[model samples]
Target: MAIHELAVNAVKYGALSSPEGHVTVVWHVEDRDGAQCLRIEWTETGIPVIAHAPRRSGFGTELLTQTVPYQLRGTSTLTFKPGGLQCIIELPAKGVLQ
Candidate 1:
């Protein structure tokens, strides 16, 4: 549902708001910090403006920063870029299907 939140946000204020914009999501399994992990990258481009990070945590932030990592027993990093929001998630590979 992380992607869903991002899509909803995109439709509301980011890339997906415009016909020329788009979002890219990629994932793979790899060894990280000596442990197997499912790595995912969420990138957005052509949004036309940069969205500054909110000062306080919101539902979307809570999902990306707390729920996902905690649920997967891993970690996540959410970045606000000049182009748009970028999120990197690393989930423990214990239950990830190869």
Candidate 2:
């Protein structure tokens, strides 16, 4: 659902909106605070111009900022850079696979 929302936004208003824009997704297991965790990075680049963060919180924003922490006990950060939007999500591996 999270990725879906990002894709939808990209298609409607983000990097995917332009022919030259692109999105890269990468995931791996990494050690954080002495614990193993899954880290996912979503990056958008090649955009001619990047929009500023929305003034209001939408469903997708809420999902990333609120629901993810409550349900997954993880963290999500969205950064708006000159290139495009970047999202990083981290989920603790301890109970994730169970």
For all predictions, the C-alpha RMSD in Å is: 1.8, 1.6
Positional deviation of residue 74's Cα in model 2 after best superposition, in angstroms: 0.4
Off by over 4 Å in 1: none
Global Cα lDDT for candidate 1: 0.83
True lDDT of residue 37, candidate 2: 95
What's the TM for model 1? Answer: 0.84
Clashes of 1: 0
Mind giving the per-residue lDDT tens digits that candidate 1 earns over 19-47?
87889999999987798888889888887
Best by lDDT: 2
lDDT of 1 at 97: 62
Top model by TM-score, which number? 2
- In order, candidate lDDTs are 0.83, 0.87
lDDT of 1 at 52: 77
lDDT of 2 at 81: 77
